[model samples]
Target: MAYHSFLVEPISCHAWNKDRTQIAICPNNH
Candidate 1:
């Protein structure tokens, strides 16, 4: 099996695509 990880800033909100192959996030800085 394989896995993945990400490093990001504090997020206020997030969403995923229908297929879940992509993602979107809104940082709290704004």
Candidate 2:
């Protein structure tokens, strides 16, 4: 899956918006 790296932070879990234009990421706190 080709994605824009600068847009999304390095995360283990994420969900794209309904339109697939934006994303919600769960940042790791470690």
Candidate of highest lDDT = 2
Global lDDT of model 2 = 0.62
Return the clash pairs for model 1, or none.
Answer: none
Note the Cα lDDT for every prediction shown. 0.49, 0.62
Candidate 1 per-residue lDDT, tens place, 1-30, comes to: 111432354334546569866667665534
The candidate maximizing TM-score is: 2
lDDT of 1 at 3: 19
* lDDT (Cα) of model 1: 0.49
lDDT for position 14 in model 1: 49
Once superposed on the true structure, which residue ranges of model 2 sit more than 4 Å away at CA?
Answer: 1-12
